[model samples]
Target: MEFNITESIQILTKTPSVISNLLKDLPETWIKTNEGVDTWSPYDVVGHLIHGEKTDWIPRALIILGENEDKAFVPFDRFAQLKNSSSRTLKQLLAEFEELRTENIQKLQALSIDEQTLERKGIHPEFGEVTLKQLLATWVVHDLGHINQITRVMAKNYKIEVGPWTKYLAILRDKK
Candidate 1:
């Protein structure tokens, strides 16, 4: 989906509730882990998710707002340090996620329609010329991808034993 500021804010706000509903009673420990695909347990997923919330979307929003995106922006690999900096509890990460999402929505909503379309440039060492709009779309897609990954990990962790209905049910979890 194209990432208009309004639609993206909706996606960001809705995700936490969706996660909460799906993971009902599944303890924060289970929701956050270090034992799933790519060695990124549930906890790592939260860490990554929060990191994306803080560093990715919000910074882009700032850039779009004509503020300095540089101070908050970091190189890709350096961002991983956030998880290590704290004991990195799941609750803490979740809290950060909520705060970041709210901030992003507020900042984005404050912007004029023209501001949303304004180009804020970033030079990634790998992908050159990253723009504010592209980052916003990436943020939405990134969250969706992780939600998919989280559910998949949960299914495996709990051994839900999916059947044909599993595929159909999965669709209910995501719009696409």
Candidate 2:
């Protein structure tokens, strides 16, 4: 499919509501449960998304647009959410994420991104040079990836209970 910025923003805008619809009011046990060691819970996933909204996406875009290609993006702290979210409740995190995402999308629209700007390059700490289009596309996919991750982690809570039906469940079988 062609990358439509409007469509991408629409998808991005819906993520918080989608997550809230799926997870809100669930028992703490479900929210906190992980498939196993080294995995994140649904709450943790929300926190991570919050961290990305605050640190990763727009900041990197600004770096690219500011013509700072010589300056590589700071390596994202994948686990920063653990420390940052310790005090916040799930509701608080969700609200914060929604608000930040709204603000970031507004900022993105204000940039007046076009074909030329989308082709602008930025230096990634590890990936070397990358286009603005690639970076923006990654932002969308990152959200989808975590959404899938959260769903799989939540579903695995019923992995053994599903018993014979496990054969039909790809989420339980996939070891990410």
Candidate 3:
């Protein structure tokens, strides 16, 4: 489907509530399990999302919109949440994510970005040049990818219990 800013915002706005509903008040077994080493649990993913809210999305958007001649964005630390989130509860991270997402959506609306603005370019450290539209789309997809990751981690919690039925469940069978 084509990228619609309004449509994108719909998914973006719903992510916090979706995550909260899925994991809130659940037992530690569900909230804290990971696929394996180097994989993030639901709580960890929430912290990562919070980190992105604070440092990635809006900051990069502003760099794209700034008056500076050089449009290069600062490199993003993909794992900053590992350290930062160690001290915070999942509830705190969820609340902060919701607040930041709401504020950001409002700010995006206030910017009054149009077709021309979406086409504006910025420099990515690894990807070279990219457009505002691509960046915004990435923000939406990034949230979704983490959500999927969280669910996959949770499903794997039942990997052994499911036994033969695991063959029917792609989420459990797909070891990646």
Best by lDDT: 2
Candidate 2 achieves a global lDDT of 0.91
lDDT of each: 0.63, 0.91, 0.89
Clashing pairs in 3: none
Q: Each prediction's TM-score against the native? A: 0.71, 0.96, 0.97
- 47-118, model 2: which lDDT tens digit per residue? 999999988999989988995436578789999999999898899999999999999999999999999999
Tens-digit lDDT track for model 3 on 1-176? 97889999999999999999988888989988887888789988898888888888889999999999899998988888899988877788888989999998888878888899999999999999999999999999999998899889988988999999987999997765
Better of 1 and 2 by TM-score: 2
Q: Which candidate model has the greater lDDT, 2 or 3?
A: 2
lDDT ranking from best to worst?
2, 3, 1
Model 2 misplaced stretches (Cα beyond 4 Å): 67-69
Superposition error at 150 for model 1 (Å) = 0.3
Per-residue C-alpha lDDT of model 1 across residues 38-120, encoded as one tens digit per residue: 45555566677667666666665565456554533455553483446358555666667667777767777776645535465
The clash count of every prediction, one per candidate, is: 7, 0, 0
Residue 41 alpha-carbon offset, candidate 3, angstroms? 0.8
